[model samples]
Target: MDNLTHSFVGAVLGQAGLKRTTGLAMPALIIGANLPDVDAACFFWLEGTEHLAFRRGITHGPPALVLLPLILAGILWAFDRWQTRRGTRPEARLPVRFGWLYGLAFIGCLSHPALDWLNVYGIRLLEPFSSQWFYGDTLFIIDPWLWALLIGSVGWSWWREKLGGDQRPIARGAIAVMLAYIGVNGAITWLDNATRGTMTEPYPRAYIAAPLPLTFWRREQIAQLEDGRWISSDWKGSDFGYGYANSDQRQCRLPDLTEARRTNSQLDAFLFWSRAPFASRAADGSVILYDARFYDPRARDRFSVALPDVECVELSAG
Candidate 1:
């Protein structure tokens, strides 16, 4: 999920009364909520598609999950102490309690992975121990409806707070609504997978239900079929497991590229992250690698790599 969603959830949690448990509790919750994304800084030193290989890895795993919040708690605690020392501490600030701060930080940090897993991008929950990716296919990475729910609730709670009214109940209501919405999306995902299962029964190498943005009732479906061909379709958000499949079959001929992954850094990273990979030959006689999930004739450059002197085998339905 995006940082705003995470921060909003944190703020809502605070409004739900978690913030009053300790000094700087709100900050702890909001910051810890986005703390796992510290790994995003890898884009600075990582070249080409290297980020794809590392983005949701170690930082989201168990060890970092336990340590990152503790680190956040310590920093927040020291900042509170420093404010008091400099005579800048607010009168409304609660007394600093290390235990409460740590506990709240833990709560905020735990929300990160849970929300991230509810998307198609996949998250590495057990990294360092085992580099395995998990997906929920429950929601889009950025859903406008979810944004409306979280933002609306937090806004209402903040307004009530300003009027010196209790905002706890409103916040709780918002959280419940979001959870129910997620439950509906989960059911939709399961239905889509079941439909895809029937569609790709013979050789189901991969099938994924990717949520689309803006609307809550639409998804892009991709499946790697038995004959080394990748097929795709879309599902209506309101439909149960039934969708329209494309008649065009995209066949990817697998050539012996055992050496490519070993020697080509870009291809290596792409392969590590791609769930439904295929190869193509570019117009300029370059071998183009693609991930079926993001493939588009007009957007080939986005998730494609052109390797010189290598040719990819391809078969057309026509």
Candidate 2:
């Protein structure tokens, strides 16, 4: 999920009455909720798909869940003390307790991976211990409807807080509504998976069946057939939104850029991260690599490389 969603969730929690627990409680919650994304700093040094190899991995794993929050709690604790020494602490600020801050930090940090799992981009919750990817396939990475619900409650809570009224009920209601929405989407994913599972037998290679953005009822299913063909369609219930792909671009190559992978470290990272990878040849014979999961005409896919002037295209026989 995006940072705004995470921040909104934290704000909702604070508005739901967690704010009374300690000074800087809201900051602890909001920042800790987005703390797992500290790994985003890797983009400074990492190029291309190196992000996939690292992000949402150990940072979102069980160990980091504990340690990262501890660090955040310690920081907030120090900040509060510093404010006290400077005599600039807010008059209404509650007494800061390390334990309370730690608890909030833990709650906030834990929410990070759980929300991240709600998207098609999977996360490794157990990383370092295991490299497997887990997907919720529930919410889109960004959902305007979700934004409306969260922001609505947050805005209402802010107004009520200023007016000196209990806003917990409203915040709680928003949380409940969001959870119900997630459950509905989960059912949609289950049905979508069941539908795609049946169709995969005809392809029998690799596939990704994930929820699309804008609407939870719709899904985008992309696959590579046993014979090196790519097929994609959007599903709403049992009906396909755009029908099955019949365009020339629908035919995809199961590219084996093994030698190329060996020569280029970035390509190696891309291959490791690509779930439904396929390749096509550019006019200059360079291999244009893509993950079928993210293939769309409107968005630009950048995983292409020069195929070293060799016959690298190989389709599965059986």
Which number leads on TM-score? 1
lDDT (Cα, tens digit) per residue for candidate 2, span 82-125: 88899988888888999999999899998899999998778888
TM-score for predicted model 1 compared with the true structure: 0.90
Off by over 4 Å in 1: 197-205, 235-251, 296-302
List the candidate 2 regions with Cα displacement exceeding 4 Å.
197-204, 235-252, 255-260, 296-318
Question: Cα lDDT of all candidates, in order?
Answer: 0.79, 0.76
* Backbone clash count for every predicted candidate, in the order shown: 1, 0
- Model 1: weakest 10-residue lDDT segment is 238-247
lDDT of 1 by residue, 1-318 (tens): 999999999999999999889889999899989999999999789877778889888999889878998999999889988998999999988898999988998889999999999988788899989878898989999888988999999999999999999999999999999999999999988987877734644746777888878766666777765656666665332111121132222334756777978988877887788777776655554566777666654455546666767864565443
C-alpha lDDT (0 to 100) for residue 44 of candidate 2: 96
Q: What is the alpha-carbon lDDT for the whole of candidate 2?
A: 0.76
